[model samples]
Target: MRLFTIGFTQSSAAHFFGRLKEAGVTRLIDVRLNRRSQLAGFAKEGDLAWFARELCGIETEHALALAPTPALLGAYRAGEVDWPEYAARFKRLIARRRIETQLDRARLDGACLLCSEALPHHCHRRVVAEYLRETWGKVEVVDL
Candidate 1:
C-alpha cells in the first residue's frame, strides 16, 4: 500500500483539485495544525467538501492523527525530535490521545496528507510523510 502526503501552499484550489483527480485520490487526510485558513475558498471546509464531491467525487476528512502541539515544538527544539532525520518524534506524540487519536485506517486509494506549506522540504508535513513511510511501508510525498 502506498500512502501519499502533500501540501498546498499558494496553489489554486482548482489546480490542486485537478492534480488530486489525476492522482486518483479517493480521500484527503488533512494534517494541518489548525483547520482554519485565511485564503479565500480554502478557508471554508464546506467549500472544499463541495469541490471534492463535484470535481473529483472524492471525500475529505480533517484527521487529527497528525496535529502539532507545544510538546512537539519543545521536542523539535531540544534536538530529540530530529526534524531533519526523517522519522519525526512528532508523529508518536501526536498519536497520543491528548494530541491525536486515530490510525488513519480509512481508505488509502490516492490518499494525500494536506497542509498549508507548499514546499515539502520546509513543511512539517514532510516529516509526517517520512514517519508514515517508515511505519507503514511504501509512501509518496507530493509537493505542489
Candidate 2:
C-alpha cells in the first residue's frame, strides 16, 4: 500500500492541489480534529471537499479516529507536552483505538492523510502513517 501524508499550512491553494494531483492521490483522508475552523481558509471542510472533487477529482473524507483528542491537542499546544511526548501519546491513543482495524485497507491505497502543520516532522499525520505502516506491513509512506 502507498500511503501519503500532507499538511496544508504554509502552502498556497495552487501548490496544495497541484501536489495532490501530481501524486495521483485518488482520495484525501482529513485527520484534523477540527475540520471546520475558520482559520483553515481554503482548507475548511466543506470548501476543501468541493475543491478536491471538482478540481482534482479526488474524494475527501474525515477520519476522526486518526485525530488526537481535544485534551491531547490542547496539552501539546499549551507546551505541557513536547513533540516526542505528543507523538508517543498519540501512538498509544491510536493503538487503543485499533485504527488498523477501524480503517479500510483498500481505501488507504493512493490516499493522502491531511493535516494543517505544514510539515510531517511534528504532526500526528506522520505518526498515523508510520503506525499504519508498522501494523499493516508492506506499506510505503510518502510525505507529500
Per-candidate TM equals 0.73, 0.99
Residue pairs with backbone atoms closer than 3 Å in model 1 (clashes): none
Q: Lowest summed-lDDT stretch of 10 residues in model 1?
A: 97-106
Error of 1 at 5 (Å): 2.4
Candidate 2 minimal-lDDT segment of 10 residues: 33-42
Tens digits of lDDT, candidate 1, 12-40: 87778877888778787787666655563
51: Cα error in model 1, Å: 1.1
- Candidate 2 lDDT at 68 equals 100
Put down candidate 2 lDDT per residue, 1-144, tens digits, no spaces: 999999999999999999999999989999999998999999999999999999899999999999999999999999999999999999999999999999999999999999999989999999999999999999999999
- Best TM-score among the predictions, by candidate number: 2
